[model samples]
Target: MGQKGKKIFGISWNVFVLGLVSFLNDMSSEMINPVIPKYLTDVLRTGELLGGTLMGAIESLSSLFKVAFGYISDRFRNRKVFIFAGYALSTFAKGALAFTRYWWDFLSLRVLDRVGKGIRTAPRDALIAESSEEGKTGKSFGFHRMMDTLGAVAGPLAGIGLLYLMRGIEIERAYRYLFLATTIPGLLSLFLILFLLKEGGQEVRKKISGVSALKSRNLRLFLLVIAVGALGRYSYAFTLWKAGELGYSLEGEMAFYALFNLMYALSAYPIGVYSDRVGKKRLITVGFLISALASLAFAYARGPGTLVLAFLLYGVSIAIEDTAPRAYMADLAKDFEKGTVIGAYHTVFGIFVFPASVIAGWLWQSYSLTYSFLYAAVMNLLAFVMMFWIRDKN
Candidate 1:
């Protein structure tokens, strides 16, 4: 093992540093994430349909760039620079969101922020895969997800504290202060990526486009299954909105969102380790089933108790969905094509987020909130069926 291969508590040094980077970035991101929907509705006065459409469009549009950047990074054999640029761009966009008074400006800033995510995600995951010890890919991605979600857990709790501290301020100003403050952790994450993370010397393979990654039949099927799941996976903003619908105050809503992240943080690592032994496909299928169950819980939720169960189930489902799939993709890809394959996977999953969210919002605006969740449940059930058709052994 070279310098990058050295392990800290069984994780590669680069992987550990990247986890730290994500922890800080996610802390910044989640602080803003749980509040974005509320901010749009309460402050900017956007309707539910518009808010959800904007959120989905922000995610889907940026995600379209992943394959391009992933292929570029793979071609250049450089991950660090793309990773740094992406995070930096997002941090700037998020911080500037504090100043937006117009919905269009808000949408622009949000798209800029997600574009940063698109740029960084594939390269970052590929770096983690490259840094992992042999046969420990699942564990490596798991550790990264755990650290990332721990930051998510901390972010909302911090937001609750901040909101309390600013209880006397006007609500709009208070939200602005929160957005501005996210810059602190976002910048810290960039620091780690710039100074500590290292790119390894990867095998030289023949030049190929992102489409070349589609040669794997298993991967093609897996992408279809995940696309179905993505169609059902409404934005987390809906969860926060649910708390509002159930009559929770702002602090209560933040705490509720934190619980979801807490469950996600706690479950990711152990599940990752478990997948390493039992097989990622099995765990991933379970994740989709859990997501379906979570949707049903939300669809039928009558009060706080049902909401709690829904949040917990959704959290665990997301942990599995976010972690195991990447590791599974790593297992399938040639070493040289990790970024391209994972980027393609993310692209397929992300592209559907726009329509899913818009449809959910449309359901809420046109009929009822329960209908939106029911729609999600149906899509997840479809994905659950599709999962069994894959031929992968692990």
Candidate 2:
């Protein structure tokens, strides 16, 4: 059996280190995430549509830099530096979030936060890929993703808990305190990376353009399909927005949001492990179909019970989508420039996010919520149809 099969108390060393980093970092990000929509509308007075649009815009804009950082990491043949810098930058950005009093400040700081993610994501995934034992890629990446989702699970719970603790304080001021406290875990993640993460000796491969890295016909067509699907896959902030739309109290909505992350965390590793046996392409097609159903569920759900099912479906969709796609990409890309290929994928997908958000916001404001969600369902269904043509033998 591979080292991937031999986990030391359920996690291999390198995957454990990276997973710890993600856990702390996600705890920090998720704390504020559950409350951000309400924060923008209630505190900053940005209103609903603009709040959703801004969230998407910042994510898309910040993610645009991932391709460059990815190429830079490949050119240097050093992943650790970018990883450290990305975490460090985000830590500082998290610290700065509390001082913001305006919408632009929110946008600016949020984008700065994503800057760290943009810089780190591709290189970090490359590290996970490099660290994996042969024939164990699915388990390795899946384990890392599981760790990441674990952080997502804890972050929202911590956020809501903190809010409960500061119950007597003004709500806006309490939000600031939450932002300030998030820095500790964020800093810890960066601190641990300095010790826990290390890179292997460099191989002297010719540097390639990020775009040129997608020489495989499968990768190109795969990316095109993903980008098209991304048009309906707006940010998760919309999920919270939808919860609030359903008349859940802020606290109730936060809990519901946390439930989704919890499900995502639980399912990520198992799905990854299974994909290793079944082949990733078949699982990915199934996930797209699930997402289509989830979208429809979110659209029509009238009560908390129905919404719970919707959120769980969303969680299952996310877990499968997030894990299987990476495994498939790892399967397809050349070892020499996998970081660049992943970066290109993140970049194009992120670029599409801006317009998707805009379209969603427009539809949301101009039309009914039912239409807004059904539109997403329709796009996902189209992707489900297109997934059949992926040319995979599975």
Candidate 3:
């Protein structure tokens, strides 16, 4: 292994520590994510329109702040502070969710939770990138993703146990217990962020001019590709909704989710290694194609077999897209301004998701669930075409 490779992959303690932090944090977040829609619609008696609206608002709004917080971290030459504060804020949000009674209160807590996500995401990602060796970026990112998904796996299982415990309990009461359970892990994540992960000094000393940064042909093209892909990427809540539409029991839906995550975890590292070997663009294009087919299958699926196929394909597509895109960004980013570039990428990408989620929700509410799936399929096709236009020579 080269020095960078050896440094990043061989014996990097920081990678392990950061991965643990994400594992715990994601466990905290995922515990809430899959069940939130049920809580809103079934427990609180909120309409689908309101549920979708809340989800769309939280996702888009959270993305908007990722850029700002990322830039702030870059400018101040600090990563740990933002990371620590973000986790602390998230802990508070989880605690606040336990107290929510009305729809607006739930929405408020959701926004606060996403705000914490926005504040932490870019900075945390940048820190991971900084800690990695140059050539081994994909592996580093894949490792982090593996840990993140491990938490994702744990979260729903935790939710299942809580649900079992509260089997005869009121729905609101169940949520209260779930929220309280999540708080312990969230607080633990904060402690890890504060003490375990080492902070690296900012890589870029001088900020590039805003217009110039935007004008970078490679970056702009890459951002376009990401935005196009994101338009097809609806929220995971929609997936759970789809499972319900197929007459899945709560346990069955959770099992499918667990399977999806299992596939996702297994695929992430291999795909990341593949991207590093072949090229990010090729893998990304394949990812879009796979996602397009999955969306189509989702739209047309009639039985459990087809639904299982769709979910499996969806998991594979996530593996390809998630690992490749960040590695692509890291490849294109100027060494000095990686944080700014990534912040810009995420901010712009996020701008697209707000509309995508709202549109998906509105389509599902107005027409049919099939319409939402079809919409995603069409968007993925367009994204596939856009991917071919960009040159990966940078």
Candidate 4:
């Protein structure tokens, strides 16, 4: 490896290992993602209104807990334990899906899985940042994202395969098979977390407490920007729903999802490297605009061509949002409580996502899917305006 590559690769091994853990976890998680909403509506005979509500509740509740767990991890200066516990929780949640016959049971397990995500996400990202050098933060995060996306790619593929294998079976049985198969990857992720990733070397520095960190003017503004951006962004479930409306088969929809992940994975590193050179704030602004455009396309699209373009733009937007915001958090955070700060940032951002999703779901049901997309597009426009207020020196 050359100097930059060598440096990135050196600390990046931890990221790589963590990526493997994510890969396994995503393989488990994605199996559920494209299927669960359908299962709720089609198999369990739950209505779309209830399904959307459940989705919003699970996502928001999970995000709320991430803030709490992230603070706990930072105060204790031990990230590994939280990570391990989080993975274990997810493993259990995946298994629990097999037994879920009632809507509440399914929703409860979804919340549990999200709880694990909320706990692990901040500390895990903090670890990636701490393991890397300042200039390489974007690259490090990008690499981690790539690994996460790799799992995203694999998970749905596995789901597609399982669906094919059980093609003749009843829909509920097919979901059960997917749930059981997903557990294998989930448990494997936990095992990797235990054996591969290291913990407990870095000392917690003396700094402002979590509440005080939230008081920082720059961080507060950044959180506001992310919240606005998130409002414009709806869940990917909407994208799949759009594809279905366009007459794409489930397999075809999965292929499009795979295509999106492929682009997202390929773009993450390059975008991260570019952001490091250009400025994270600038990249974030650009990302929001791209997402705004994508939402517009989705809202107005009347045919397959427009849907394809929208999904492509959606993939690129994700590349920017996922990598740049993370790099920005690392830049703004104090060394001692990096995890806590990032957690707070995500927590605040996530708190808004719940309302955004609920509104999006409601709009989709009551008004039109196009209106939901328009709502998200408007949020992105507002986020674009807010970018002018952000100072990027950090």
lDDT of 3: 0.79
lDDT of 2 by residue, 1-394 (tens): 3324435556666577898999999999888888888888899998657876897897787669877887788778888899999999988888788999999988889889889899998888777776676666788777888888889989989988899999999999999998898898998998888986766333314445344548767777777777777776867777777888888888988898889999998888989889888988888888878888888988899988889998999999989888887777766666677777778878887898788777777778888666667887887788788887778653
Model 2 misplaced stretches (Cα beyond 4 Å): 1-7, 201-213
- On TM-score, the candidate that comes out on top is 1
Which candidate model has the greater lDDT, 3 or 4? 4
Give the best candidate by lDDT: 1
Q: lDDT of each prediction vs. the true structure?
A: 0.89, 0.81, 0.79, 0.81
> 1 or 3, which is superior by lDDT?
1
Clashing residue pairs in candidate 1 (N, C-alpha, C atoms within 3 angstroms): none
Instruction: Give one digit per residue, the lDDT tens place, for model 1 in 6-110.
Output: 889978898899999999999999888888888999999999999889888987877788877877888888888989999999999999999999899999999
Ten-residue stretch with the least lDDT total in model 2: 200-209
- Predict model 2's lDDT versus the native: 0.81
RMSD of 2: 2.5
> Clashing pairs in model 3?
none
> What's model 1's lDDT at 384?
87
Candidate 3 lDDT tens digits, 244-282: 888987777877787777777888878877777888888
Tell me how many clashing residue pairs each candidate has: 0, 0, 0, 0
- Give candidate 2's TM-score: 0.94
What shift in Å separates residue 7 of candidate 2 from its native position after superposition? 5.6
